[model samples]
Target: MIELTRDADVAMITLRRPERRNALDIEHCDALREAVEGATADGVRAMVVTGEGTSFCAGADLDGVYGEAFRESLYAALRATLDTPVPVIAAVNGPAIGAGTQLAIACDLRIASDTAVFGVPTARNGLAVDVWTMRRLVELAGGAAARRIMLSGELFDAGQARHYGLCDRAGDVVAAEEWATELASLAPLALAYNKLVLNSPDAGVEDDRLSAAFDACWASSDIEEARAARQEKRAPLFRGR
Candidate 1:
């Protein structure tokens, strides 16, 4: 199940099936996407994804791990995180194995608690993640580390993940939400543009949309607010214009 709540302008999405260590089944995956979408629709500036209880997520529930339905729903949930206009942070509190790892990597940033562990045991299960997931893993964790996770089913603790750049910080959900709260104070349009360009880095040399976004940021009134605030020695109040 998915439980969504809010902290000021930051949305919190928690995976709540502690009974199975919050493992993803088809229904849970669908609910996750819905929670993300609903929060986005409500105009949150940032979001934090986490799991309930001690475990972040064990893996895909073994009963549905071998089925096509599970795969589709799983990727759909991941895509919801990827496609959100605002940034999402993963608060990994414990073992994020298999699909759990995919979910964590899908977020813009990750904060792994000291008790957290990350791994993809696909090879052990005789299964494989999608090309996009693999590429994203390589992008965030680098190729060698990605290979170690996939090929050897190696689990990295919070410290190791931070060393490998997989986890941006080592802390619990509180730290993740604190970061998101800080992010909420920034200019939304600029953050959205950054996310856009980062997600589609090779949007072509002559990409008009990219150029437009760049120009928009420059032209936004938030820039003026920033200038005035700087002159006054105060933080800019960005209106997302």
Candidate 2:
């Protein structure tokens, strides 16, 4: 199950099936996708995803992991998170294994608690993640780390995750919330455009989409507001226009 809540401009999505270590099924994945899409559409400036009780997410429910519907829903949920305009911070509370790792990487940033652990041990279970998922792991943790995780099937603790660049910081939900609050106060248009460019497959490449976003940011009213705020010695109020 998925629980959606808002605190000012930050939306929180909590995975609620602690009994099963928050393992996701088709229904849960669908709900996650809906919640993320709805929150983005509703204009939430930032989002934090965490799990109830212990265990961020244990990955796909073993019973349904092989089903086509479950795979479809899981991918859909991940795509929704990746495509969200606002920033998403994954607050990894505990073990984030298999699909759980995928979900965390889908977010723009990851803040893991001291107790959090990460891994994608599909090789151990005779399962395999998709090309995109594998590439994402490589991008976050580097080729050597990714190889160790997938081939060796080893779980990495929070410290190791941070060292590998899979986790941005080691912190709890409160820390994640603090980060979300800071992100919410920044220029929304700039953040959205930057996130799009950073997450694009053609990042750092010349493209019309990237050029347009750059142009829009330069021409945005937020730029003037920033200048005025600097002169007034006050915080800039960005409308994201």
Which model scores highest in lDDT?
2
Report clash pairs, candidate 1.
none
Q: Judged by lDDT against the true structure, how good is candidate 2?
A: 0.94
* TM-score of each model, paired residue for residue: 0.96, 0.97
lDDT of each: 0.92, 0.94
Candidate 2: residue 10 lDDT (0-100): 97
Please provide, for model 1 over 44-141, each residue's C-alpha lDDT reduced to its tens digit, 9 standing for 90 to 100: 99999999999998989999888899999999999999889899999999999998999999999999998999999999989989988878889999
**What would the per-residue lDDT of candidate 2 be over residues 166-189, giving only the tens digit for each residue?**
999889999999999999999998
Which of the numbered candidates is closest to the native, going by highest TM-score?
2
Model 2 misplacement above 4 A: 203-206
Q: On a 0 to 1 TM-score scale, where does candidate 1 land against the true structure?
A: 0.96
